[model samples]
Target: MTEQIAHEPLDVLRLRARRRQAGRRSFRQALMRAATGIIGEIKIASPSRGRLIDNARPPASIARAFEAAGIDAISVVTEEDFFHGNLALLSKIRRDTRLPVLRKDFLTTPYEIVQSAAHGADAVLLITAGLADDQLQPLLSEALEYDLDVVLEIHDEQELVRALTFDPSIVGVNNRNLRTFEVSLNVSKRLINRIPRHILAISESGLRSPTDVIAMKQAGARACLIGEALLGADDPRAFIAACRPAFVA
Candidate 1:
């Protein structure tokens, strides 16, 4: 199924996507209500670290655990080659959980956005590093057309500058450099405040503990996307609860 979708014509993919319902769970509103939102990820593998989890454990089962743990949203790595994920995983996770599911992939085309919607994604990650200047806005616009929230992901000052031009609703500052695949929390710290207060900022990568999440929140990030750490934890639900910020009464 995944291989077939990858080879399908753009028009055919669009038609399939359009046939499915568009209005999905809101990824934006989920973060807006939290003091510090936690987006638990269902990542099976990665290029930098190799396979992270036993793929034998169903993705939906993990998603259900996240929902039970009070996760604000879910991120599913759907990039086939390096991540060992596909849209089918996204679909299964979406069906099994109420949390808005994000499609985390190196998407470079409008067709992929439509495919995301067809597969039941509530949002899609658009990496600034992967997109050309002209390519960014159009791809963003395509996601918007399907009512899929866009996580405009950036890694540096230049990408941040380009992302701001679009006035993205949600900006994700990825700590891992796409080129080097090296992770750091300083990347989020350096850029979080630079993002306007009105736009939701999500700190991604290199976050392993509640203390790390607190630091990002203190630095002005409203949410943290934790994948590798959560998947590797002895108790993911307990880890998520600990990572959540204290709520003000």
Candidate 2:
């Protein structure tokens, strides 16, 4: 029998785990909350379990559909292993759409922030599960200097407190737990009340239908980051358009 091989480094895994302890706030939390539109998250991950259709749509094609649906932002996953995303793809998507682009990656160091800005990204995703609060603040300030938005992603209440320390303009409650990789819509509902009305509150992960989007919005999510469901659809634009009537015009 062949032995399983490790793909990610132990140090990288350690760095990601350490982020839960260093709580901080971010400036972008407010903008995300104030946003009146959806934030379309793009990913070209290895196919999901039991996937029947092999014809996953190209990133650009999907991005165009997102733009047509009037999304507030576009987040391109740059991680390669699980998501099969690339930084170069982000640059490509940026050239194709007027919407603000967010580089979604497990960003650990300052160099990565510079790389994101240089790559033509308008924003960067800093997960609360990936960086210490102290480590996150400086990076937040630096990204701001470049005029890039910073969206902080947190998994739970502890992470939320840490996220708040940075005073984020947008704070996303990712329903997917990094450790367990489980998702629940209630995650957004549970965290919404704790966040001030001034900050933009967003729900990330596991949002599937129009009903799901509405539920999230009612739970105080200014916007919802949707990807898998849209990308999996036969016509992403049509599906997204169908959901538009529910949001305030």
Candidate 3:
């Protein structure tokens, strides 16, 4: 899988995991109290679930609906092989949507980051498990230099520690395990407590209902990158509305 690769040695993962834990008061407060943002996503397919749309609407149209739903951000998956997503979709979404657009893909190189910027991405997804610290450091630095926000994704305690080495302000705890392609809310519930303050926390994948969305927030996620469930819904607008009630005053 593109999500699983060894750029950093195994010892690095072990060593980083050994670093100081982040269960401080300030950290816990940041996770629990921050106002949550909604990050709706666009993708026509998935490697694990097959096709998402029978006749996919144009990226611009999808972005328009999501914007109308009052989502805080837009995530456009651009992985061509598995998701059938493309850079053109991202560029088109950027042009159509007033919201910030995040380029979600299996980014492994600095080149992909550059492409994300050139294509009108306001941010990019970087999975810690996909690249080593040696590669992650330079690529992350380059993304910032390009003025693109980085959504650093991690799955477990080890990956979370490894991700912290870069001092990212935005973190994504994916509920779906990339290696096994299994979905579970426990992943985020278990890992969210470890993430500290001043950083925006996002829970990604397998969020299927309003209750699921609320649960993620209570577990310390400040946002969610929702795609599949939203795409498969009978009423995308209604579903989006439901996911946000817990966050509303």
Task: Provide the TM-score for each candidate, comma-separated.
Answer: 0.92, 0.81, 0.83
List where candidate 3 sits over 4 angstroms from the true fold: 1-36
What is residue 66's positional error in candidate 2, in angstroms? 1.8
Which model is ahead, 1 or 2, in terms of TM-score? 1
lDDT of 3 by residue, 1-249 (tens): 233224434344333323311211122232235344777889878776788766646667877987786677788888889899888888788778677778899888766666566667778889999898899988888676556778899999999999887889889999988999888999999999789857788899989887899998788778877887777677767877787666753
lDDT accuracy of residue 171 in candidate 3: 92
Clashing pairs in model 1, backbone N/Cα/C closer than 3 A: none
**Model 2, runs deviating above 4 Å:** 1-36, 46-56
- Per-residue lDDT of model 2, residues 168-222, tens digit only: 8778899988888788999999997788888777789898987888888788777
Candidate scoring better on lDDT of 1 and 3: 1
Q: lDDT per prediction?
A: 0.86, 0.73, 0.76
Q: Best-fitting candidate, measured by lDDT? A: 1
Give the true-structure RMSD of model 2: 8.0
> Distance from true position, residue 35, model 2, in Å?
8.1
The worst-scoring run of ten residues by lDDT in candidate 3 lies at 20-29
